[model samples]
Target: MCRWLAYSGTPLLLDTILYRPKHSLIDQSLHARMGVETTNGDGFGIGWYAPESGSDTPAILRDIGPAWNNRNLREIAQHVKSHLLFAHIRASTGTAVQQTNCHPFRHGRWMWMHNGSVKGFHEMRRELSLAVDPGLFLDIEGTTDSEVMFFLAMTLGLEEDPPQAVAKMVGLLERTGREHGIAAPVQMTVAVTDGTTVWAFRYASEGGARSLYYSTKVDSLRAQHPDATYLQELSEDTRLIVSEPLGDLPGAWNEVPEHSYGIVHGGHDSLHEFAPIMP
Candidate 1:
């Protein structure tokens, strides 16, 4: 399993969310409180959409090393600014420890990351890979089930309806796994974005999913704790959705209900029940 965080708000230095928080993602990389494992140091990655002039697409920086010891990450985090970002720390389930296996996988304007695994991934890998469109298949650069799941969503129309397409892809994987006698085909807590909007899902073929959480009402928190230093420093529209709360700010986090998805854009947020797509 792994730990990840997604940010959608007024552009700010990456350090504000990745390092400044009391329980920042970098801290979670070594001291995760809710993940299956406390340490997720296999590798880490960060994806962010720079202003149009910065680059043609989201800039991705990935490495096969511990987040806590990455000097380059610290340097970039202090300078880069983006309205949408995805950062992940990995604890490999079955994949080799390589840079490509790090999360926050990118595709055009979209960036994705995942925690948890595709149960019996070795058994389902072939079928899953074969299902990807040839065009998309050629783009896959890694062997992690997380990356495979990303391509599967794109093959099934992630750009159009990310949540639905991901659900369909997961459903297909589960069905294919069942055909091969795998009762629990998928286990995932995934987050994705197309630069502007974000979609996060928590689900598993076995009915028990990994930990996923989102922040609470920014307005509510600001009103309740006007003196909270960070709350006063942040933009009124700032919002964070993560695998765990960044801090213990009372009334500052909400648990995403099991088997559900969350969407965030322009400071607004919504959640939907996750349903498997029938073959």
Candidate 2:
């Protein structure tokens, strides 16, 4: 459905991943190899913690246009630096093409993006929207299953336990969808962050969700391929969880198993099986 990435590690210019890679996020917007569609030109957005501030909140920039041709994105990518960041290119799955609908949706210190969507979202939107806590519901600015999912997670306690909150959200969503007669209602490769850490998930009720991957330990990559020049410049803690591998560098990327979630921070990285819990 879409292409996105979540990066956590040493501070870096946003372009280092958004534009400078052999196949960057901008390039993927135009020629995505793994997305259901090749072009994700509906819109784009980037959210990153302020460089050197350790701020709880993040700065967000989004536009309703092809990222491949967005000069503004290029300008910011070259300047903004942060230890944690999220970038997404959207391929609308029946949602309006507008700035508010772009991914990396935010609230307070949290930022989130998704690559897959709920089946029959039109039928479930009203119920799902109503399920969100009223205070958070007022903040819902876009009409996409992804945004609803974000608010749902928030309503269920995203700030306290991201994985569990998301699990609870999925549970409620899937149950609601089934009530409305749709099976296998959720398919998602989602990433969420709160300045210092990032949580990523890949799951679907049908067991075949969209693809997701994460970079291996940078130091480990260097140890395995001492001659790989790029590995030398990156910080050892750098970790990138993306909808697809940025490149085909052997031993550099690992697929996040289907129906699983991962957490990435400075020194603690973990993976766990994901299962929905009905609310």
Give the poorly placed runs of model 2, Cα more than 4 Å off.
Answer: 51-54
The parts of candidate 1 lying over 4 Å away from their true place are: 52-56
Winning candidate number (lDDT): 2
What overall lDDT, based on C-alpha atoms, would model 2 receive against the true structure? 0.90
lDDT of 1: 0.88
- Expressed as tens digits, the lDDT of each residue in 1-279 for candidate 1 is 899999888788999889998999999999999999999999999998877666647889999999998999999999888888899999999799998889889888788898988878898899889999899898899999999999999999899888779889888988988889988878889999888888999998877788888887667888999887666666656778899999887888889988899988877889999988954
Scored against the true structure, residue 236 in model 1 reaches a CA lDDT of 59
lDDT for every model?
0.88, 0.90
RMSD values for the candidates in order, in angstroms, are: 1.2, 1.2
TM-scores for every candidate against the unseen true structure: 0.97, 0.97
lDDT (Cα, tens digit) per residue for candidate 2, span 16-132: 888888778888998989889999999999998874575678889999999999999889888888888899999998899999999899999899999898998999889889999
Residue-level lDDT for 50 in candidate 2: 77
Clashes of each: 0, 0
